[model samples]
Target: MPELIGIARLAAESPSLLGKKRVEYMSLTTRSYLTRCNNPRMPFRWMINPYRGCEFGCKYCYARYTHEFMELRDADAFEKKIFVKSFGPRRFLGELRKLPVGESIAIGTATDPYQPAEALYGVTRAMWEQFARTAGFRIGLVTKSNLVTRDAGVIASASRRHAVTIVVTITTLARDLAGALEPLAPRPELRLRAIRTLARAGIRVSVNLAPVLPLINDSEASLDAVAKAAAEAGAVSLGANVVYLKDCAKSIFFPFLEAQFPALAGRYQERFRNNAFLRGAYPEMIRERVGRIRRKYGLDSSREAAEPELWPRDPQLTLFS
Candidate 1:
């Protein structure tokens, strides 16, 4: 028999958690719910992903590589085969308690914490439910779902205890285009509603106009529309990043373009064939463009430096910097 060592072993033996006709939810036993991000460039000190696969299935998702660790190589598997990590309340809190106070922890780094499964599994819900009891930590959550609005009260309470920021990613304001790009995510209008609701509840919220695809949605007008809506909806900050395509994402994205954006596929294939990050003028221009938009709306950068005294006991940290 072939050796199924480490994570692959656990992945193979995981029990079924839930089943949809087109999707399968598996229960993955986990030793630690929190992980340290050693990369110096990462803004947060720690990361947590409640679920392994995201059903939103955005055509340009860069997180596709995460599923490879489970030995699932097919691109579609990231969306179809979901893994819900087993959660033990006390244990989850225990691991959390061990971390020093005031350290930053980013949620949903690899996948959506509030993915559709979260409605059923409630792992993300449990996280905030427990976090409300804690004091003095920096928490940031990134998601593409408006389902987070359901826990607005709990999140607001937790915000009172610790520094909490919720970032709702809306790549475009055009509903049809958003549907085409992020097929399964909530509509752009719903996401904007979530932002307004969260902001009204006194929770700090931001907008991420990320993975700004070249020649697709990167136009000034396209980005400006998202920013204007985000600001009008009560977002205090906004951030945008150019698309970074790795082999894993390319395998899926390239084919998606051929089918949906055939005219642009060839250019994208050539541009990103060698490098993952599109550096130089295009990215710099985006930086300038996003900067202009941020100023125009009186908004802050999502990774803008935190006030040094937000947590006086520790050194200041930049979120997603």
Candidate 2:
């Protein structure tokens, strides 16, 4: 177990609250709700994660190491112990005002904001209500849950004045494979239904076929099926990225592969042994595959960032421009 300090230590000291199946919800104090991202590779500069640990428990989740910061060494603790950030709408709105206008904000960068806990605790929905008051902001939300559709009204209200995009992440349409990969997340078919609901509400929707596993869900037929579904559901764009095996993720994922997919386990070990990312030919092939799928479905890889007419002009934002 790594040494725990600061916020992680505080959260560890906090008493556990509700227990559900394998996961336990723990409440923690949050001084701030938004974080500024300095990663140049990412499109968004600001991000908000309503929860610290995700309940989805995906095999390839790269965020398991986040538990290490909390002194929870057991890799499984990342999924078994969930922490809900103490939400303050007033404080969150203040933090939002600090962001420079035109900068993008991504919700659920580290955890699914609309995860199962959301049904018991409506934090994600509350945040959207706060967003409804702001204008001239760019917001992006990604989720694997159909629960997002429950807040479609708030999302539509926010979109009236801001550039909002809701991305539904669907790895594969195969029920058994999806069941094994994202055990607790909503089914692929349910996510598609949510996409259609949001699109009909006039909210920009997209489908993300991310963490495209090599031997599992990366087949041409599989990718085409997801792309076609997104298009038929009225998605405006499509995007995908191959799997990345970070150190924390590999610790759990490697064993999972051995048990579930013995045939491909050895290949995965060799491919990820020397590198966290697959480079050279494999990535190039995936990019070409994704591009072809997008074109086939008439989906754009990029979205226009123009400000909507309803956005309230802000003189302070001009300073950052």
Candidate 3:
């Protein structure tokens, strides 16, 4: 593992080289990195994860499963111990040149790129520089942190050249609720500020009211408030979706729910029982409510309607195969 001292040196000297070829020694350094993903359900054919293990520590983070794959345990360590991928920029650019051009690229697919660690690592900015140097590709960023504002210049430039959409994921405007659910993420207001900053800079900005916890953040009033906020902030698009708890996320999320909203915990259990995906009328109900709010706010329903599925599945790829 790279030691903290070496990581700092690398970050200071060359922060963008996160791909495999540039990585010589694995270090426990606080460096910036990226990963490539080919999940069919994802809208982009490729993805870049600048860091491993999220500091946001949202109880319902599906990326928690990634920690186990990295041979790490102890959920508490998720926030403190972050792995920075070395030589990320070089690797990313190299791969970018080799791959078919003009494909959509998604950042922050697994872990947020603008998390607090970014203030120090500077990997996300480095990655943006690399993307800016290249052309013929669409770039998308999904983050819950307002820190993205720090790079508004680069984001705005990227928008001018290619398709770049910034999706700010804010589940609820309630600070208390946000704190309880996403213990380490930035407050909703700060994320809203980021939206405003990016929008003012002419960058395409959107709001993703994701993981709308059932009986928690799923209220009609809550969704409307979010839509209103997004529109007022100059977001060109808005979207909402029910929370899906998978793997260890269930373990971490349910307990938090039981403690925070005791009265409605049973309702969630009953609703999600035997259903991996939250189904039935709840999704439609929320979607309809969100649509009505968007129309009322004079926001384009087209962005919401045209939102691409995260991934397009291949029928030929069977589960077993």
Alpha-carbon runs more than 4 Å astray in model 2: 1-4, 303-306, 317-321
lDDT score for residue 41 of model 2: 95
lDDT of 3 by residue, 1-321 (tens): 634344344333433323333122123433323345666766776677877667788987878776565544555445545666554567667676664445677888878999866877788898777766655556788999999999999877656545688999999999998998898899999989999999999888889989887777888888888888888998888777788777567667677778887887787677666665787787888878888877888766432222222222343321110
In Å, residue 240's CA in model 3 sits off its true spot by 1.5
Indicate the TM-score of model 1: 0.94
Give residue 79's error in model 3 in angstroms. Answer: 2.9
lDDT scores of the candidates, listed in order: 0.88, 0.88, 0.71
Per-residue lDDT of candidate 2, residues 210-248 (tens digit) = 999997899999999999998999898998999999988
Off by over 4 Å in 3: 1-38, 301-321
Clash totals for all candidate models? 0, 0, 20
Per-prediction TM-score: 0.94, 0.95, 0.81
Q: What is the alpha-carbon lDDT for the whole of candidate 3?
A: 0.71
Error of 1 at 134 (Å): 1.0
